[model samples]
Target: MGGRGTRAVAAVSAAAAVLTGALAGCGPMDDIGLGQSGAADGGVGKGAALGVSPLKNPDGTGPGLAPITTSGDRAEARKLIDKVRTKGRGPKTGYSRDKFGYAWADSVDGVPWGRNGCDTRNDMLKRDGRKIEYREGSNCVVISMTIYDPYTGKTLDWTKQHAAKVQIDHLVPLSYSWQMGSSRWSESKRKQIANDPLNLLPVDGSTNASKGDAGPATWLPPQRSIRCSYAVRFAQVSLKYDLPVTTADKDAMLEQCT
Candidate 1:
């Protein structure tokens, strides 16, 4: 927590300053639950404060990915990106989703939100979503929530019925990881990277699908303001696992911070 951390914290703090107080008069808005009425009545407003900056949320446990504003934070982001090693991407011959363990297994040890009775998807839904509604009789199951999709800068009134509308994106896509040498990793290591909150983001599904296995070199969030933050998150995951990004991807990431 140096200059970079302090500045990023200040950015989030200033934006959140307006939201410090609770809802004043809980009249009709409280009837259908706070967030349940949001989508129907246009209650959930859009703003940059909907999330926390990657500069402060290195562990990715905070909330959504907030844009990284200010020259200082961008400079700091570039420094972090510079630390990631770069190499030519390998091959994708023997990779599969199963190779990283079943989707969102709570049983995976050593990662945040793991083995917490809820699966990783719901955990992320709870973590990034605001005004959450849970399925009846289950605290771990999320029925609906208001989410700010940083990838597209859209606020969604997401429900379980249309589960594919929002997807948890891997900042470093698993297939990309395979090409970057994850195929040579132990199953446990692969699972850690796959389930690690630091590498995951709840974003617009279509945007994420369009990303495929492409790195920063080829794909990025459509919201220009969030690109640097996205690049930083990518670097965080790479550094944490001692993984190497492709040279092109690393260069692209550095450019985002500028």
Candidate 2:
């Protein structure tokens, strides 16, 4: 039995050598690292040590990250909206031009929070801007940062001077919130909505101004291609925050989504 086993091992080794030699001359099997392991065949190392090839499209680009969606609970959003819609407006809130400078607000609700405290602009600057550069080391607050504009697919090197070039857009405008349900909310809750990342997007400054407290029924992205994702985000934010949408706004959203 031992002699038969030895003979079988010898036959298998001989067959493997023959097969390896045959395959080495052609095809993808040309560089099998059998005996000359490591630095052989131009430093390819072991066969099993190769890294995975990155998946790419025919055009050689990798897939993009999925679009942003609402983070707050939808039920909680609805409750908040219901609560705020019934309430009356809080104390007259005023925003300083020095803090926002050149950024326009259409209604009292547009600048819901006072001065620089809990400003949507600052919140968005923190959330959307990357590699933030501050005016002074003493001021931990960011004066500027790199922003990627999803609307136009452009990277903007935003600075404090050009900060007005990007604006924090409310997916559901504050005035819409006021009419729908925010009128009923406490000052604290209103401030939360103002600073919510889920509702804020850094978009073209002029475009955001033009949007001006309008709902989906009245406004859509000037860049037509982004409208779908914009509508989805709008619906998600409103539904999450319990903000009521008019029939027209709902219809427009459906059209954009479809």
Q: Indicate which candidate wins on lDDT.
A: 1
lDDT by residue for model 2 (2-120), tens: 99999999999998988787667533444332211222332222331211111111110111112322333323333333332223323324422222223322222433232444344
After aligning candidate 1 to the native by TM-score, how far in Å is the CA of 192 from where it should be? 0.9
Superposition TM-score, candidate 2 onto the true structure? 0.53
User: Using Cα atoms with residue i matched to residue i, what is each candidate's TM-score against the true structure?
Assistant: 0.82, 0.53
**Which lDDT values do the candidates have, in the order given?**
0.83, 0.51
lDDT of 1 at 189: 92
Give the clash count for each candidate: 0, 10
Candidate 2 wrongly placed segments (more than 4 Å) = 1-120
Best by TM-score: 1
**Which residue pairs clash within candidate 1?**
none
